[model samples]
Target: MLDLTKLAQQMQGISQQLTLEATATRQRLDRAQLLMAQANERQADLVQMQELWRDRLNFTAAMPLESLDTRIEIAAPPAAHTVIATDGSQIAPSHHEIAYCYLINVGRIILHYGQSKLPLLDSLPEVFYRPEDLYVSRQWGIRTEEWMGYQRTALEAQILAELAQALTDEMEAPTLALTDGSLIYWFLEQLPAEARDRILAPILAAWDQLRAISVPLVGYISASRSGEALNFLRLQSCPYLAPDCMTHCSEVVDRAPCQVLDPLKDAALWAIRLEPGQRSPLWKSSARIQEFYGDHAIHFCYVNVGSEIARVEVPAWVAADEDMLQSALSLVLGQVQKGYGYPVALAEAHNQAVVRGGDRARFFALLEQQMIKAGLRNVGTSYKETRKRGSIA
Candidate 1:
């Protein structure tokens, strides 16, 4: 009986050890599965890159540029300058409702207009303006209204025509044009080449005139909050606001000190200036910083601008400092890249106003109403409620 009892105790100990080992082995298997998943994701990304390169190479090889004796002209920055900031705002109907976006572009030019020390010229034509309403179907799956195909093309043509008129009538000749987004919309791919050429030709002609007079063109895009770089920054515990803040990620890794404070109240705030530094892993190889916010944050250039790059950090408390103002302008540029493929307008109508918590429900309600008004079909609510009866007598 004593030997039997000792044998039972040893068996119990061996069983417990086996159970522990089984658990550990299961955990190792789970870890291996997770690693395999990650590797597969990386492999997929590599395949996508290869496909993109193939497409790009094919497109470039098929399109050959006609070369001419084109002389390259470089323009020097003005000793004393006035900066003109222009922006455009639009509210257009999507498939189901309307959407709003704005653009702001800024540039410095030799003060040509009046006696005022301010660099702003009152006579300068508005670079940013809103055009007439365009009724178009929302085929892009972004918003859900279906309009005729020609509607989008017509609206784009009107926008381009208005832009050309503004450039000719109000803008000074030989002045730099600073745009908040890409010079051309990527959606141009959907339009016929002849139509695209017709719309862009005038704009290019205006640009050439400015270039001939030694005026440089620059485009700036802000950081996007929803972008991969900013998302990574948020995950890494960097300070940033949501929704209203710009979203695109920058590839440059540089830091500059900036004072972010309320100047009117004499209070201090947290602000940092961005200085260009080494390339970051986050940036695409060809990316360049048009504006910098801090280490690992910058507004990147998506289009070529012939202007000299300058950066300045300012205290947030100072109500206005031109150099600092330019930094703030950089954020607008970033927003253009992240939000809409256009520059931000400088006017108050185009300003990115913050929505308060109290207004959240109201905003959505208005949006729903607008969709209804726009004739977008909707499905019934997906909710049901049940009430329990009180105790019966």
Candidate 2:
């Protein structure tokens, strides 16, 4: 149990830190705007600087497209449009469990507004216990959660692709598809080359399906903490010609010129750059994982949908097309308005996919029952697990 008294003692310090940060952020926002203007005027220079720095640039920064300060009012959504979203939940495998297995459930939601068809809400659950399924990651002793997360992400994309492609072919009006988080598979960068390839295969295939069908696919993140745009803006104000952190910052203790914008994130910065129902210009992500993504490299923009700024990401294919990009943001804004600041379809997809504590308990109980029915003994059942459960208060 958490010690309330200890937590309460630190609460005051936390509050003080927040106050100091907020004050500093206000100061930085002023400078950030000035630097943004300077940077916008030199987009070509900044792009060149990125190329010159290339592999040496320590920070992951975004590339400005045309203008950094460009803001477009929310597109008037089509009268009849469809928005579909998919979210995934997983039960990671554990040795402490009765069954050493994992589960992935993808929740699919399709909401039709100003159309005759009723909403579609369903979930697809899959279990993995086979040796091939359990050890797909190729890591000897790494934690299972990371591999499970990738599997769930792939499943969500595949299911969303099937739904979106069918709807795009069938419907006359525009159709949009959304996944809960980013399209950038940044996590895969940490894995071995073979493992990364194995995991990314299905995800790229799913993206190809939607791309072939010309269905706009989006990755939605609410109150995103992505520092891509903020990091890019910081480059404009760097004191050094090259902004080489490794060589130049060896003697500097603190970020004298750049730390002024330390507290700002993409969402917070875009909030100042945009008004309600407006979106900032698109920017391409510079994550190293993009090297592997190739044509599906991720691009993103910030949208102020009344309550807060939300980050919306898309594949390179969708981002390059003006009509498709506008249709996506407009429908996203409409969904946010309907849900009162969040996407309604994504919200419902989460509700259908979430695996709670009680559900986890029942799942293990069912596993134990099935093992007993199969006339097999759970010989390696965890002793510490039972001890923890039966401990006297």
For model 2, what is the alpha-carbon lDDT of residue 147? 78
Q: Which candidate leads in TM-score?
A: 2
| TM-score, prediction 2 | 0.93
Residue range 187-276, candidate 2, lDDT tens digits:
888888777877789889999999988888999888788888878866787788886777776567665566567767778778777899
lDDT of each: 0.30, 0.84
lDDT of 1 by residue, 25-94 (tens): 5554444334324433454443344334432221111110111111111233333332233443222222
For each candidate, give its TM-score against the true structure: 0.30, 0.93
Stretches off by above 4 angstroms in model 2 are 3-6, 138-141, 244-246, 250-253, 256-259, 378-381
